[model samples]
Target chain A: MSLDTRPPRQTPVRHVATPRERDEQRGLPTRSLLLALVLACITLMVVDRTSGEDSPVEPVRRVVGEVLGPAEAGVNAVLGPVLGLPEMLRTNDALREEIAAQDDEIAELRREAHQNPYDVARAEDLRALCAMATNTGYLLAPARFSGYSSAQSFSSTISIDAGADAGIRPDMTVVNGDGLVGRVLEVTSHTSTVLLIVDADSTVGGKLGESLESGFVDGRGGLADGDPLDLRLVDNTVLPEQGQQVVTWGSEGTGPYVAGIPIGEVSKVYEDIRAGTYRAVLEPYVDFTSLGDLAVVVPTGEDTRVIEPEACS
Target chain B: MRGNSRLVAALLIVVTALLVQVTVLPHLAWNGVVPDLVLLSVVGAALVTDPRFATLLGFGAGLLLDVAPPADHAAGRWALALLVVGYVVARLAHDYQAAQPGPQPASTPRPPYLLMLVAGAGGAFVGTSLFALTGLLLQDPAVGVGALLEVVLAAVAYDALVAAVAVPLVVWVFRREPAPRVAHVLR
Candidate 1:
C-alpha cells in the first residue's frame, strides 16, 4: 500500500493545573490504600480466629495439604528401606536374644507348675490379672506417621497415614499398644494429625492405679534438665505414687476419649511446698522416638467397667 | 548447553532435598533434631549464583520447604526471609577476588568467604526466628527463648556444612568455559 502524504492533523492538548484536580487524584489513591489495609487486617483477623477455633475449614486445609502429601509419601517410601536396614538388623539380633531368654523362663515356669499343682493355679491367676490390666480386648487400627510440626516449643503434633477413610475422626483417642498417645485433632481423607500426650496443649484426665485417685495429667514442654514429662497433680486428694500406673478417665460427657487406656507410669513424685499438690513426672508409655506404628482405639459403646476387688470382698 | 542443563539440575536437586527433609528427616531425627537440608541447598545456590537470580532461587527453595509437612507458618514467610539471605550473599560475592569468575567458583580461600558464611548463618537465624515468632503470634505459648535459640543454632550449623560442599560441586558441574586455544603462526 502507498503511504498517504498529507498535512499532519494536531489535536489540541488540554493541561489542567488546578489545586482541586490534583487533590482529587491524590485523595483517590489514599482512600484506596486505606481501604486495602482495612480489608487485609479484617481478613487476617478472621483467618487467625478460625484456625484457633478449630472450625470446619478442614476441607480447604486438606486441599492445600494434598500438594505436599504425595511428595511426603514418596520421601517416606524411599527413605523407609534405607532407614529400616539398620533397625532391621538390630531388631533381628534383639529378637533372637529375647526368644532364647523367654524359652528359659517358660521352661522354669513349667517345671515349677509340675512340682506343685498350686503353682499352676497361681500362674493362671497372674496371667488373667495381666490380661485385664493390659486390656487386650480392645480393637486397634495401626497407623504410620509422616510429618510432625517443628514449631520448637509448641504442642508437638504428628501426621499419620490413617485418616477419615480409615474410620478416624476428630477427638477420637489414639493409643499405642502400651498406652494413650493422644486424640485426633484433624482428619483428612487419607491422613490424620495427632496431638501427642506429651505436647504442651494436651491434657489427659487420669487416675492413679493403686489409690484410684483422679487428677489431670498436663504435658509440661520437654523438660528443662532433659527430665521426663512432669504431670501436675491438679486434684488435692489425688496423690500419685512414684511407680503408679496412670490410666485415662473417660471423656467428660464427650465421646472423644475412652476410659481405662494406660497413659504412663509415674517416674517421680515431688511435693510442691506452696501449692500442697504432688507434681508427678510421667514417662509416657509410648516412646516418641520409636514411634513407627501406632494404634487408634475405636470406641465400642459398651464400657469395660472396672470392678473394685476390695469392694467385692 | 551446560548453563541451561545446570539450572534444570539445580531445581531437581532442590526438589529432592525438600522431599527428603519433610518425610525422611523426621524419621532420621536424633534427639528430636533433624538436619535442615533445604536451608543447606538454598545456601549453596545463593553462594554459587549471581545476585539477580538469588531472590528467585531462594523463593523457589523456601516455597518448597513451606509446602512440606510440619509447616506451621504461612507459605511465604520463609520465601521472603531466604530472598533476603540470597541477596546479601550475592552482594558480598561481588567484593571477593578469592573465587574465580565462572558459573561455579573454584575452591575459594576460607577467610575471604567468611562474609558468605555469616550471611548464611544470619539468614537461617532470621528465618527460624521469624518462624518461631509466627508460632507465638498464633497463640502457641510453648515457644520460648531457649527453644528458638536451639533451632537457630542447629539450622545455621547444618546449612554452613552443606554450603561448603554444595558451592564447590555446583561450580564444577556448570564449568563450561571454552578451553584456551593455542595459536600457531603460518610458516
Candidate 2:
C-alpha cells in the first residue's frame, strides 16, 4: 500500500463553460441562414443599383409599396395637420422677413383699397386675366407630399400622393409657392417620387434673374440641411453676383423642368479658369425641410415629345 | 418559419416607427434633421434579443424601408447598415451581461442610461455612415463631406436624445423574463 506500483489515475480537468461554449451549449446559430440572408441583401443592392426600372426587386418593392403606401397615406392624412403644427410654429429669419414683406404689401394694398377702390378692383381683374393667359402655356396639377425619402441620411426625394392615376409621368417638374422643388423621378399607380432640384444628380437649364446669363444648374443635394444649389456657368465671361436670382431655362419642349421656375439665388461664385466655367452656389427659394403642397408641371395636352432621361438607379 | 409573436410584435413596432418617421418626423424636423425611429427600434430589440433574430429584424425592416417610396438609393443599403447595427447592439448587450458574474445588491445603482447612450450614438453612426459610404463607393458623391458631417452629427445627436425614451421601452417590451435578483432598470 505504501508503494503503489501504478501511478494514481489522473483525474481529467473539465473545461470551464466560456461564453462561446455556453452559446454553443444553448445552440449554434445556423450559419447558412445568415449567409443566405446577407448574400441576398447584397445581391439585391447590387442588382437594384444596376437595373433601372427593371430589377427583379421591383416586384417586391411594388408589392411593399402597394401594401404599405395606402396605409401610410391614410395615417399621414389623418395626422398630417395635427403633426404639422410643430413645424408651422418654428419659423426662420427668412419666414420672418417674408411675413414683414407681406405686411408691407398688405399695407400698400389697404392704402390702394381705400384711396382708389374701383381702380384697384379693375387692376386686379386685369391681373387675373393676365395670369390666366400666362398659365395657359403649362398644365399644373397640385399634389401633397405624402412621405419623405426613407433613408434621410443619403437620399433626397419625397413621395407625392398623386401619380400615374393623376396623370403624373416621370420627369415632370414639381414646384411650390416658393420656387422649383424638384422633378418627378418615378411614378407608380397612385404615388410618385420627386427628386428635388437640390439632389446631386439633378440638372436643369437655368438663367440668372438679372444678367440673364445661362448655365446648367446642378444640385449639390444639400437642400435638406442647407447645402446650397450649384449652378455651372456656361459663359466664362460672366460671374453671377451673390443673391442674384436664378430661374430655370426650359428645354426645347416639356423637359424635366420647364423654363421660368425659380431655382435659387446665387450665394457664392467660384470660377474654374481651366474649365472656363464658374460654379455658383445658390440659396434655393424653397425650404425643402417644410415641403407640403407641390404642383407637378405637365405639358398642356398630349404632346408626349418630352423624352424622360433615365436617372441613375 | 419566422412566426414568433415577439418577433412579429417587434417587427410591427419597427414598421409603425418607420411609418411615423416618414409621415410625422418631417413635420417634427428641427434644422432639417429627424430621428431614425427604426434605428432606435433596432437598438431596443437588440438589447433583448439574440444576434440572429436582431440581424434578421434589421435586414427585414431595412428592406421594407428601402423598397418603400422616397427611397432614392439601392434596395439594400439600409439593410446592410441595419444588419451591422443590430449585430453590434446584440453583441454589446450580450458581452455586458456575460461580464457581470452575478447580480448586484439592491443598494447598488443599476445604470442603463449609460448603455442606452452608447447604443444610440453607435447605432446611428454605424447606420448613417454606412449609408453614406455606400453612396461614395457607388461613385455617387451626392453631398460634400461637410454636408455629410452635418447630417451625421444631427442624426447622431437626435437619435441619442430619442434613445433614452426608445431603448428602455423596446427592451422592456421584448424581453422574455427577468433574471432572479437582477432588478431590471426598464421598469
Candidate 3:
C-alpha cells in the first residue's frame, strides 16, 4: 500500500467513516494479500517438513544462527549480571557466611591436593567430563551454552558456541558433567543446535545400569528443564525398582550416543495393564534449566595403535 | 520523513522484542513458557498502523521467530501463526474504530488498554494453538493433549500480562505517525 501524505487542513473533519470506507480509502491490507501471505507460509512449511536433512530452509536457518548467535551472546553478557541481581541479593548473606566457612575448607583441601597433586587445575564440571571422556575413550570438543530455542514451550533445544568449526556435526552426542544432555541436531559455522533429551520427540536407547535390561527412554515435552522421562523396557517381566541407575545403551557407530553415559535414576515404576508392559520414570542427571558448559563427543575411528610383543624379545 | 521514522521505530521495536524473546525471556519463563514478545509487538503495531502494514509486520516477525536459532520445528509455522494474529488484530481495531460514535481527534489517541489485553490474549491463543496444531498434524511428536492445553492457556495469560507494558511501548513509538485513516481523509 502506498503511503498517503495528506496536507494539514484548517479544521478537523467531524464526519464518522464506516469501516469499509476507511479500509478502501486507506488501501489497507485486502483479502488477497492476506491469503497470499498465508499461502507462502504453508508452502514454506510443506517444503521444510518433507525435505528432511537437506531442506531449503537449512541455509536460511544457518545464516540466521551465524548472524544472531554473537548478538545474543553479547546481549546475554551485558544482561547476565542484571538478570542475576535478584538471586545474588537473595544469597548475599549466605554467601558471606560461606566465605568464612570456605576459607577453612579451602585451606584443608589445598593441603590435601598438594600431597597428591595431578591435574587438579580443571573446574569440577570439566574434570568430571574429562573423566567420562577418558573412561569412554571418545574425543570431546567442549562448548558453551549460548541460547535456547525460542519455542521453549513446544520443543526443547539449545544452541552452543561450538559447531562445525570445532569439528561438531549433526547427531554427535552432547553430554555435560552429570549425564547426557542431547545430540547435535543442526550445525553452522560457529554454532549448533542440540536437541535436549527432555524434548517430547526425543527417544534414546537406555538400559538399567546394573541388570543391563534395555529400554527406550522417551522425553516428556512439556518442560525444558529436567522434566521426567518415560522409560519403556523391552522385557515385560523385568520388574525394575526405584533408584536403579539408567545409562545409554550406545548407538551402532556411536554417532548419536555413546555407551555408559549416565542418564538418570528410576524414580517410579508402573505396569501398563492393557498393554502388559512395564514403564519407569527417570529423573535426568543434567540440570536443564542451568545448562552451561557442555562437551560434544566426536568418536575416534577404530584404534590403529601397533602392539609390540615385549616378552618375545 | 514521517514514514521513515515510523519504519525505523517499528523495526527497532520488533527486533528488540525478538532479541529479548530468544535471549533473556527464557530465563524468566514461568512454567517453561516464555511470553511471546514478538506477538505482543505486532499487536501494538497493529493498533496504530494500516492493516496492510500490520499483516506484513506479523509475517516478518513470525518468519524471524521460525528461522531463529534452536527452532527445530517446521520453518513456516510461526509465520502462519503471526500472519493470522496481525490480520485479526488490525481488523478488530478497525471495526472498533468504526463503531465509535464521533470523529476521532486529529491527534492519535492512546491505544485502548482493554482492546490490547483482549488482542494479546486472543492473538496468543490463536497463534500458539495454530503452531502447536500444525506440529501435531505433521507427526512431529508434539506434546499430548493435556500438555497442549497447558501451553495454550499459559501462553495466553503470559502474553496478556506482558502486553500491558509492551503494547503501550510500541504504541508510543508509533505515535508520531498520523493515524492512517485520518491522514487519508485529510488528503
lDDT of 2 by residue, B99-134 (tens): 777874332123277887788788988998887787
By TM-score, how accurate is candidate 2? 0.49
State the DockQ, from 0 to 1, for candidate 3: 0.49
Cα lDDT tens digits for candidate 3, B3-112: 66677787788879989998899998998899999998998888877677888889998998888886888988989988888888888887787688898765446767
The reply for model 2, stretches above 4 Å from the true place, is A1-34, A84-108, A114-313, B1-3, B103-111, B176-187
Per-residue lDDT of model 1, residues A1-313, tens digit only: 9898976769655787577555343222233433443354335434534565453434444664787688677667777788878766767779999999999999998988787976564444334333433464554555666777776746678889888776677887776645777889999988998888777777888887777777788876542334346666556746777788888888753236678888888988788789777788887777675465565655445233222122221
Instruction: Give residue A149's error in model 1 in angstroms.
Output: 75
**TM-scores for all candidates?**
0.42, 0.49, 0.51
Clashing pairs in 1: B104-B171
Q: lDDT tens string, model 2, A132-216?
A: 2244345556577798875556667889988887778898888765678888989998899999877778888899988888898
What's model 3's TM-score? Answer: 0.51
Interface RMSD of 1: 8.9
